[model samples]
Target chain A: MIHSDLIRRLPASMKLAAALAVVLLVTAACGGGSSSGGGDTAGAAGLEGKTVNFVGYGKDNPWGAYFNGVFVPKLESQGVKVVDLTTMDPGTAVTNFNQAISNKPDLIVAALLDTSSTVVPIKKAKQAGIPVLVFDGRPDPSVDADVMQVLSDSEALGTAAAQNLVEGLKAQGRNSGNLIAITGTKSGFAAQDRMKGFDAELAKTPEYKVVDIQDGNWDPTLSGKIATQLFAKYGCSGIQGAYGMADYQALPIVAAAKQAGCPVGGKTGLVVTGSNCFKVGIDAIKAGTLYGTATEDPGTIAEQTADYVIRYFNQQNPPAKELVKEERVTAENVAQFAEQCSKA
Target chain B: MNVMSAPPRSDAPIRRPGRSRSRAELVIDAVLLLAVLAAIVLALTTHRFATVANAKAILTSASLVGIAALGLTLITIGGSAVSLAISPSVAAVGMIFLSAQSFGLVPALALAVLCGILITGVQGAIVGYAAANPVVLTIAASFAITGIATGVSGGSTVSPTGGGYDRLNATPGGVALSVYVLIGLALIVQWTLRRTGFGRSLYLIGENRRAARAAGLPVGRTTAVAWLAAGALFAVTAAFTAAFNTSANVNLGGTLTFDAIAAVLAGGTPIAGGRGSALRTLAGAVLIAAASDILLLRGSSTGVQILVKGVIVLVVVVLVHLRTEGSRA
Candidate 1:
């Protein structure tokens, strides 16, 4: 909020610059190893003719939709020929990496699943003198050091959502309630970190007791089923709040909350918050059915990740890690976030 | 009685529903009985497990797996090795179902089923006509289909929206719609296995391909038809699966394919090929759901759940093997 507030205070030209800086932050977190921005963009404009190879984890899932349908297209539209190498888990990442090294493009960007299997391929790419930008999951130093390791601040996202829920709980004149955490896949890094961040924040406040944490596997249907199960067990009046790992996970919880005879949003509804703002989540916020969600902003992340590298190539000076601005969207400010949420 | 109420009208070389009494059968039966008892104990001991909501969940969860198992049941009964591709094939069907939502669900569903039949029938032709190994071919086919489905959907989840197909996932009269669909389909499969002339051909071909071929039976044609039937079964199952999740998930079919194989084999179908029963597969599916539900209620992880399921399968296989060995002794 302070970040956006600062942007609001700045002049229009500076505001756009600050916004682009947020995208620069995306590259810094995962791979664009450095985070320093506001460097000389004098030669950055020369990147228009170069080709970039994107090796994304795109095996027929929603996240893949964003990567393939949204993120990749946005990059190619920047006048660069993009070779899309999207594959699923279980050796697909390895195959894509192998292909990238074979092609030896100007730049390589990827979203990886397992770091262990990719160490060899990534090292080979480095040996071939190609710079790699990785977003999504972080690569262990054992994997690569020279790469850009930009990732979403899932911990911050989770913390914000938790703070938003606690705010709702306080508005209802209480500090503690039976809150549930509907998590993503039990084994996924993103879900694990988000829950960790949530727990860390909630631990400071003793009143908001997390009664149960169920794994939703990041599926809305599974989330709905788990919510119903919790409702059936605790009844409508028993549970007070829910923190969904993703909006897709949280949206259905809202309906189930209602079906369980509990209101949603405002001071009355079970305070519900989700990370990764989807259109459904934004709509829920507008309808006052959901409390908050973090702006994942894949499009911005991809664009900035590529844009920053181009700037570096032009000036031969890498930017430091930049933090992509993720504001927790509540009903009071959901209108501002609506257009961004609509992109994917 | 219907298990015994069958006579071959084609002067079939092999009987469709004949059983050689073996102690392995009894042992596997005991193991299944033990699993049921374990679930009952959990239900009685836990308030949540015994609740109506939990009961419905168990039934609905099993329904999806059991429906797909029904098709695999036919394929195995027809002597095709378990098609690893069944899951991916069904997943593609789910994607197709999601894409065709604007044109009306029923029509889309029929079209999807027809396509599934064609794809599966091709697998059958490869195995039957080319004499390609069923296991290898179907595994390859599964990968190919999954790859294509992933490409078409562009890695996006096509979830069902609006009230147009709400009844698909509705739980009517305290029973999930999927449960009814499972029962109806299971009954149809059972009937097909018992009453149809094509049904007897499956047993003959599976019993001895050379013998059936010598008898002038259309081996390739029967194999393709069997695959077509199984494909139809899988197409309907995929629709329910998509409806269950409210989205077309590419990974939806992966877990169920093996679970369905386990269910059919544990339900009373022999691995070497001879006998199969839809009722048994349903029981196996129920057992799996009940076991998984109780374990899940106890807060088990997905890895643990998978381990438990694998253990049950291993136990059944081992018990069957030991009994067969002891009988020979």
Candidate 2:
């Protein structure tokens, strides 16, 4: 009876084994091995052959695409191999970091979507002896030893943007009017800092009293939808100025303003300022669609991040703990910076 | 529509060996298989989809979903409905374990399983006691579990770092482990359904609770047990997901609730319950995964994918319902 039962199960067992073998073979054949290739600059010293993992929030976003296509190539010319791992959502970021850590990659370049949530993991990466590079977002002090934060000065960016908006509004003969602050996410580093800086600057200009401050969560669709309600509820007659955290988030809002037939850009228009220096944002600036924005060249971040990773590999003290620069872009200087700022 | 009320007729052929399968059954399976096959072919034609790597990615996603689908299969069989919280629960469990065990894979897995069972059991008991609408009950449970996950992980991602990432990314080998676990679950479910009196009691209860109780079957106990079994399966599949993904986010199991229900329906399992098997459900999951991969490779946006998924599910459900009607005729 036992022998017969065993014989009866043989085909099923064989089929399972065969299926497993197929999976294994495929995995092996595809070079799905643990990233064993260490940090090696075969030809160029900075980043030619190295795989710099970029862990960020949304890889599908156009901004993410620019980083991969345009920015990473710029890094490549600087000798760095950029492996875009930006799909590490709120759920997978830690595991992604761990994967990079296990692979013992030369360096980890990450964007902490929520500064608070990513602190522990960044600190853990630091503990694992992996040098970290942070961009577009701030890092908590707890993970300072392990990280080199490269961020745009939100205060400077915000102040400069506010100044530009002030000048634009003044040019329009509405020197100061009711201003509304539209932020993508209310709690994040960039959002919070930008809002605070904008508020402080606007406060100095006593004529501009902040009328409304609402969070649009950095979504274009949501911002546009909200802009409609804000217009109706807050009365755009006195709403002479608008500040948005990012261009992508601001795009729809601008579209809504135009739909409402509100004045935009040229002399007597709704003065606005946004960040991220996205190509679309620059295009808007060039077309007198909006005021100016604080620009952090994304390509520079990728290149510098790659170099920092290589420096860690070489056991050289990784570049300064923080690489921040105040590069504000306005309509006046935008023409000169458009070539470098443009991202296809 | 009233398969349960339809009296057993002498003219009907039993589903035993030597009896050729019905034409309707063949048609249903053919249609389902064709859809799956078409997806694979489409994916193959697309360069990005044809690679061994992308294939593994699809399978990895499928396996995590399949594991949860198995639990859903059980709940479905038991006549209990649930929501997408299975993924979040899995994430919570994985994160709990990962956080506690210093990246110890086995312990984290065990904890995740335990948490899945306990949470599901609590939800099942409430469902059984109140006999509330499964849809509302599951939605409520989803929120509660999601809240707890957020609280536990503090809205932070709990992922396996260092060597943990390797074991998590071990696609073929890791996937086999999940598949085996699923097969094991299927075998146990099949055995319970066939050999154990409890299984029959559960099925009878699902078919007609009052009749089963009147017939001296322990209907309530069996129903609860069925739910409990589903809970166990849900947790196990969840662990497999965390293992495969190498991390669990607060929203890890969010997608499974809908996918599992859809898979159960597509696999010839009546939403009203009392019909289906783990094997059929697994096939449904594969079909769904295959379809998704195809659409994604075709440059379909997330919107298109969602629409297609809903349509496929509805079509499959309608076809299955039609098959049963035809079978009766």
Poorest stretch of ten by lDDT in candidate 1 chain B: B7-16
Interface RMSD of 1: 4.0
Local distance difference test, per candidate?
0.72, 0.63
How do the residues A185-291 of candidate 1 rate in per-residue lDDT, one tens digit apiece?
Answer: 76667787788888899988988888888878776655665676676666667789998888777766775665445677766668889878776677668777788
lDDT of 1 by residue, B141-256 (tens): 98799778777766665655443444576656857677899999899888887788788778777767787788877888888888888888889888876655445657766566
Best by lDDT: 1
The DockQ values of the predictions, listed in order, are 0.24, 0.02
What lDDT is reached at residue A11 by model 1?
94
Per-residue alpha-carbon lDDT of candidate 2 for residues A247-339, written as tens digits (9 for 90 to 100): 655554565465444667776778887776666677678778768877665655555555555565455764556555657788889987676
Worst 10 residues of 2 chain B by lDDT: B4-13
Native-contact recovery for every candidate? 0.28, 0.00
The docking quality of candidate 1, as DockQ, is 0.24
Residue B32 error for model 1, in Å? 6.5
Candidate 1 lDDT for residue B255:
65
Which residue pairs clash in candidate 2?
Answer: A47-A79, A47-A80, A48-A79, A48-A80, A98-B161, A184-A217, A184-A218, B87-B253, B88-B253
**All candidates' TM-scores?**
0.79, 0.46
